[model samples]
Target: MAAYAGLAFLSFLWGSSFLLIKIASRAFDPFGFALARVGVAAAAMLMTSAVSGKVWPGSRPGLWVKLLALALIGQVIPFMLLAKAATLTTSAEMALMMGAQPIFVFVFGRFLGSSDRWTWLAALGLAIGFAGVGVAFWSPGAGGGAHAVLGRAFALAAGVFYGTGAIISGAATREIGAVRAVTASMTISTLVLGLIGLAFGRLPPPVTLLEIPLGPMLAMGALGVFNTALAYYVYFRLVHDEGPTFASLNNYIAPVIGVIAGAAALAEPVGPSAWVGLALVL
Candidate 1:
């Protein structure tokens, strides 16, 4: 019950993250924003890990390789992609399209996830969820090449990456506790984002520092410390306890809150398709 409750709350926090990224991306380049967010998350994790006496993954060579892969798929690539996509897309569209996640997790989680099969109800729920995704994407609002489409595509791509990472994290969590797994993943993502940002000339420009507002900074700090770190920690525990099938339900719950938040906070339109999608999913 504790784990379930924690996972539910985790979804609520994470639901708003896409909007925060949209705000942060305005201040930093895509990779730069990704780098900064994950960088802050990593630094926070490092400090917490030190205080908590969690294993430093570098302490074990064998685990290090496994940790590295977890970082790449779980954090490094998808996060940057998400930030880039959010920069282009509307939050409502992004939220609505995320209704597809349960399908992604169900399909992927069945064959690829540690769990070999899912309950029929889970499958049916995911079918409804995918319908929602279609409605959200095909609505008149999503048809034209609006920035929302790019964002949707990016979010979709992130979903695929996120699914693959879920499978891997599902497996990896067996050996390492959730906190350690997230700590290692955040560190890897931070480093990978940093390198990519530098390689692509996407690093935060010098003006970025001066331009970052205190409000956004506070928001980012909350995101890095609470939303990203704490959310993942709770998620890892849920995944470890309940299996990925149950753990990834957060995706399903997230879109509703996300769309509402995007619409209310960002003044973005919730299109016909998005409405259609949300209805089907719920």
Candidate 2:
């Protein structure tokens, strides 16, 4: 029951994240935003592990390499893509688009030969979900323009990356323990995103940050502490306790919260198709 409660709370945190990301993107660009998120998250996780007497996984070059790959696929790439997409699309739309992640997870599970078995019901769910997504995006005029199209594409691609990351995380977590796995992965992601920021010249000069809005700055910090760090802690426990598919069930809960939160807080419009898509996703 405690585990279930934890997972539910984690879902709520993640559901609220789409709106936060959209808010934060106003101040930080893609690479910089991702870098800051993982950097602070890594710091928090490492501190928690240390305080809790969790031993670090050290001196394993192979494990580090695997962690690097997980960080890239799960954290860096998806985080950057989603952050970029948030700037272009409404939070409600992005949340529903993200709700399609489980379908892709099942598809990838087949290729990975994980325990996921697709039945007729699963196929029906997939079909319904895809149809719903189509309806949601099938709007008239500027709402379905090139930028929105591209943003939705990015969101979907992030979902694929997230699916692949889940598989990798499952294997790594089973071996190294969830806390250590997340700490290592976040550390690697911070480094990778930092380098990417430098390459893109998006790493802001320190003095320039004074001009950024306080609201967005606070949003970014909350994103790191609540969304990235604390959420990953709960998620890794879920993966370890319930398996990847079960942990991924947060995909179902979060988008609903996201839609409601976005509409309430941001006055974002939710069309009939969006409701259809959300229902199918649920």
Candidate 3:
């Protein structure tokens, strides 16, 4: 129960993140924002690791493979992809896309998973959950947009990556503590993103000190450390105790809040299918 609660909380933090990011994107480009987000998160996690007396996870020579995968899929690549995808898509559509995470978890956890066996009911639950997402997004004017097919494809790809990240976390939990897993993931993610940014000619990141609003910066940083890093801490802890499936239930909650935030705060229009989809997903 503690684990489930933790995961749910993390989901809430992350779910509401889309609205925040959308607000922030006005001043910073998607790549720039994602770059900053991961870069800062990595640094924060390193500082946290040192203060908490935590060491990196895994001593085995082969463990780097999983760690690398986690950093790339969970943080670096998905961060960039999602940030870009969000800029092009509506929050309602993005929320619906995100609603697919739990099912992705089930797919990787049960059908493709090595450690756990899945129940048919679980499969049915996954289907119902995603079907709910479709219903929630189906509308007349804007039509719970699906990211222009290509953009939505990227979001789906991010979901797949996040799903695999959970599997990596599941594997890592056996060898490392929650703090260690999260810290290591963030640290490596930072480095990997830095390397990628450099390779793509973004070295030193152009360092244009934007005179952006303090509120947005604070919100972004808060989202980074609290939602991304700290949330992962909560998430990994849950995976260590309650199993990944239970821990992942938060995915549903997060996206719903994303849609609500976008609609209520941003005044973005939502179609009726979105509510139906939310009900089905819930």
Q: Number of the top candidate by lDDT?
A: 2
- By the TM-score metric, which is better: model 1 or model 3? 1
Worst 10 residues of 3 by lDDT: 136-145
- Per residue, candidate 1 scores C-alpha lDDT tens digits across 59-143 of 7776777677878877767777787887777766776666676677778765773774667876887897888788777666633
State, as a TM-score between 0 and 1, how close model 1 is to the true structure.
0.91
Question: What TM-score quantifies how close candidate 3 is to the native fold?
Answer: 0.89
Order of quality (lDDT): 2, 1, 3
Question: Which 10-residue window in model 1 sums to the lowest lDDT?
Answer: 139-148
Write down the worst ten-residue block by lDDT for model 2.
135-144
Q: By TM-score, rank the candidates, best first.
A: 2, 1, 3
Q: What C-alpha lDDT values do all the predictions have?
A: 0.75, 0.81, 0.73
> How much is the lDDT of residue 208 in candidate 1?
61
Candidate 3 lDDT by residue in tens digits, 193-235:
6677678986443345457787777767886888788888888
* Candidate 2 local lDDT, 1-282, one digit each (tens): 977797799889999999899899988888778888898889988998999898988777877777888899989999999988887888877777777777777777778756655588866776677666666665431256788778877887888898888877877787788889989999989877778678878678889778889999899888998998899878878777776666776777788998999999998887776787778777
Task: Indicate whether candidate 1 or candidate 3 has the larger lDDT.
Answer: 1
Clashing pairs in 2: none
